[model samples]
Target: DHGSQYVSDVFQDEIAFLGIKSSPSYVREPQGNGIAERFVRTLKENLLWVRHFDTVEELRLALLEFKETYNREWIVGRHGYKTPAQVRKEQTAPVSIAA
Candidate 1:
């Protein structure tokens, strides 16, 4: 799957040369890319929806803050109220294998 930026000839060529398969969701099928769409909506609603910025730098800083908070503090219902970083840490923790 490719973002709009990845649709460029250079990206397509690189993926092709690497023997990687690439496909884009059909324009009208939001469900095909539901997870990404949902994230965008969440970001807008929780971070960008009520803010106004005069410069790209300001927007960048705001996004950085938003991402840090979202990853470290925001409780997501999907993860049983754990923050994304917490859930990721739990998932990646080492597991002992029984002999």
Candidate 2:
């Protein structure tokens, strides 16, 4: 779930230390990485292309704001027009089953 940098010893060691299982993307299959691709496209269109950042810190702050807005406001068509925040709420909500 990372770029070519994941092949580095530091990256591999960090993930191993964190006990995170790495699932490498499929070779020659762009569709397998569609979600990440779409996110990058969205980020570029919404933040990178529209704004000018004088510093890396400024860009980082803008990205955090953009992430919050996207999760709270953006309607995801694939999720029945639910924002990511809504989907997360539903997923984490307690479920009750009555007999």
Candidate 3:
């Protein structure tokens, strides 16, 4: 997240392509954004602070791996102890009709 900058058209297009929603923050209240802020903190603690990367490419790849790990293994309390990957799977599961 870039702070308070005009988001680029290309970036918006990419977000739409990836089916990600942009949640706009409320004005002048940092507390209202606690969940996202906590995630940034968690990401830094789990991935960024644990190693020194020699290059941007290395860091990018590491981040991708970290993301996969987080989705597969991280248990979120709000998700009833399920990983993010599990939640996504449940959300996308097909509905069966009773015959």
TM-score versus the correct structure, for each prediction: 0.66, 0.74, 0.70
Best by TM-score: 2
Where does model 1 exceed 4 Å of error?
1-9, 12-32
Per-residue lDDT of 1-99 in model 3, one digit per residue for the tens? 446352777777788798998776666767657877788899999889999999999999999999999899999987899999999999999999999
Better of 1 and 2 by TM-score: 2
- 1 against 2, candidate with superior lDDT: 2
Tens digits of lDDT, candidate 1, 1-99? 456668998988999999999877777777668766888999999878889999999999999999998899989887899999999999999998999
Highest-scoring model, lDDT: 2
Predictions in order: lDDT: 0.88, 0.90, 0.85
Rank by TM-score, highest first.
2, 3, 1
**Residue pairs in clash, model 1:** none
Steric clashes per prediction = 0, 0, 0
Tens-place lDDT digits, model 2, residues 13-74: 99999999877877776765897789899999988999999999999899999999999999
> Which segments of candidate 3 are over 4 A away from where they belong?
1-32
